[model samples]
Target: MFTLPHHIEFLSDRWVEEGRKFLVGEAPKIRERPAPAERLRGRPLSVSGRFTQAPPHMNLPRDVGCFSVHFDGEAFAVTTSFDPAADLVIEGDYQAALTGAQMVGIAAPGAFRTLRREIDHLYGPEALKVRGAIADPMALEVLSGLFDHLGRKTVENPDLAHRAARQGLSGKIREMEAQGYTIVENAITPEFADEARETILRTLSMHGHQTMNWMLYHGRALERLALNPSLMTLIDASLGRGAVIASLSCIRRGAGPGFIPIHTDYSHVPEPYPAFAMTGVGVWAFEDWTEASGPTVLVPGSHRARRHPRSSDDPGAGVPIVMPKGSVVFFTEGVWHWQGDRTEAGERVTLHSHFNRGILRSLEARRIDEQMIYRNPPRLGEMLGEDDWFEKTTAAGRDYMRFNYMRQLLAFNEAGKQAILAEPQAAAPTKSARRAVPA
Candidate 1:
């Protein structure tokens, strides 16, 4: 397994040191590019960055929230101080700056355009500010290349590996691959589950509705649960990165016959579905799920059929997924499923988190609220489609920074999934061997 030496928080001192080393190592490659090489033939270039209002969890020092990069034609050096005489100075909200720095693999021609578009259209003018100018516009491209190189080594989904190991998710991932669905028992604490249930009930009462869409905007609990690390790892493995929120909905159902019919999630698609997955869902159980309490039932290994269930198919073959409170059942790859009848329950409450591949349109229209983005970490924004380049356009062209960002993110997510699957599964100890060991 590939394990990081230590957790490197974004924009921390360690992140800066690692970024410096990465830039130093990539200096030679940057010089090989003809246009950038010619642009920096003789003149030295310097750029400084300043960020403020960093989230408390980031642990960045208030006084040292700045860094400068200096390139002396052939070599590069990074320092933890502002450069008053630098050719360019970029300043912005700490989170917004992190967003800009995380965009990797952007082409030189679209670098400046991407930055300008993000500042004006996405982050707002007050969120990002740029000062000073270079005589040669090509310098922006060279600097952009340097930043991209650094970002490749630094910014990443930091919790994926540790969370997977902590939750023992490798076997779950394998199970999901083989059966098209998996249940993670006690994915959250019972206390949290109760809190989420109460929040949902309150929202339902306020809105006078049995079901609510856009539940992520309803409460903090929904937001946190929606971006659960373990659930996200599974989604990343199945849907690839840059997957946007298709819907975050809550349902309050009383004792009655199952209303939803047996079907696949892939609506309007032709038969013999493609090998790749298009959509996935993680249904959260707010209370213990029993066969009679109304649980989601699915046909095991049916995804391998690669088609929807026919009327002749036996619904009796489906098995109910029974799990404890705070658990979640994740199903993908167009699995055939339906809600079971509720005979014993007062009410069955569930929060459904549905996600689609980056290339597909979402079921719920995105409402890009700035306060919501500001309150949560970049992960929440990412699921809300803030990080990817979609539905964004200008008279000049598309946002290449986000376009390239999604490409790089998807590649990284796939590689990480493979690594998780490659890990060796530990064997259970034999009875005699267990007896020989000391208690």
Candidate 2:
């Protein structure tokens, strides 16, 4: 009786063939509107204050923000509201801004900055109700909405979409400049990783997806995040289940790209569950994400920006991540980002994935009828692909096409992949890792 990793498994093509017998309806089409918060605000609510603090991961200066429990205490004005927690001390100064250990750039002052130089991203609730400490249904709803919205449109504000497209090759350059990424090890077993990769690639092939957006791993990638197990195990030993998947999937480099742009990753639903919510994203480069194969460029701390600025508009901050395979480039997803073109040649293989929990799929995207998927030009047989042909999923009893609990569960099963910093790991270490160490 071997214990299978939760939510993932391998299925024989024959077994999968038989499972597709009775088709389930496809998921509902999505609306291009803001977010799906309206649906989940049903739970009750309350907002309170305590002398607590955010998890260690969310404390990065650029990643930090000021929130007032009462408008009376400080003259400060926070752009948005976040979850209420105990032990969360409302700091009136910049000391909590950022610790030196969290700072990334060499040009920045000192060992590290105490506060974020600026606050760029803001997810204000159009209408929110903060109760005592019961959890605001509306805020939670907004968080869930942002999570889903950012999934499809990396740039939550589409106004920045086309601009972030970066030289029409997608925003790799800007992604590198604006946001950084991280690489973790042995987060997922090879067997589990293969399942995730196969699911994404197979899904893409079935869909006949090609071209710039052909990076199916972007929208459909994993959202669970893991630090160096040393980092996580060390932290978990301190916080227990309170440890959540803070950030995941911030870059994917390719070739022949140009232009740098802006964007953000929706992160209302952090990983592990209720305790880990409201964090951003991170990325790991498996192959060499170079100038040749457009690499994700980013604007430092741009997660606080209105949008990811173009490299053309702003210079210097833009660095193409020459993309050494083993380093972990950790950055906030809510920050601005884009990509650079492959000055050389050949494409790079980078995987940007993450893990999060508690955000529900919008009934807005719910597929009540199997016909929508069966008939959808974008989701037909080729897209959903040979559910009949090649292989099948053991994801039975779960709604593969519906916006039910399973979608997130499926995502969870694939979340928190050990950041792969080199070529696929072999039974024995490969030469690729001779230098794939994190900076």
Q: Best-fitting candidate, measured by TM-score? A: 1
Q: How close to the true structure is residue 126 of candidate 2, measured as C-alpha lDDT? A: 15
Candidate 1, residues 1-439, lDDT tens digits: the string is: 1112332445677767866755554445554545454556666888888887664435557723788888788766787787877898988766556555654445545544554554343345587888997666566666656666544434434334433553467667766776788777777767678989999999999999999999989986787688665688788778887788999999999998888889999977787888888999999999999888888888877888889899999988687878888888899999999999999949999999999988888899988887666444556666788767787888889988777766765775676667777877547423422221111
Candidate 2 Cα errors over 4 Å, as ranges: 1-203, 211-254, 258-260, 266-279, 304-315, 322-328, 354-439
lDDT, candidate 2, 240-331, per-residue tens: 21223322222323345565444445434332223222233335454545555666665554444433344456644654554454333444
- Largest lDDT belongs to which candidate? 1
Each model's lDDT: 0.72, 0.30
Lowest lDDT sum, 10 consecutive residues, model 2, at 1-10
Q: Which residues of candidate 1, in runs, are more than 4 Å off?
A: 1-163, 424-439
**Residue-level lDDT for 59 in candidate 1:** 52
Superposed by TM-score, candidate 2 places the C-alpha of residue 285 at a distance from the truth, in angstroms, of 2.9
When summed lDDT is taken over every stretch of 10 residues in candidate 1, the lowest stretch is 430-439
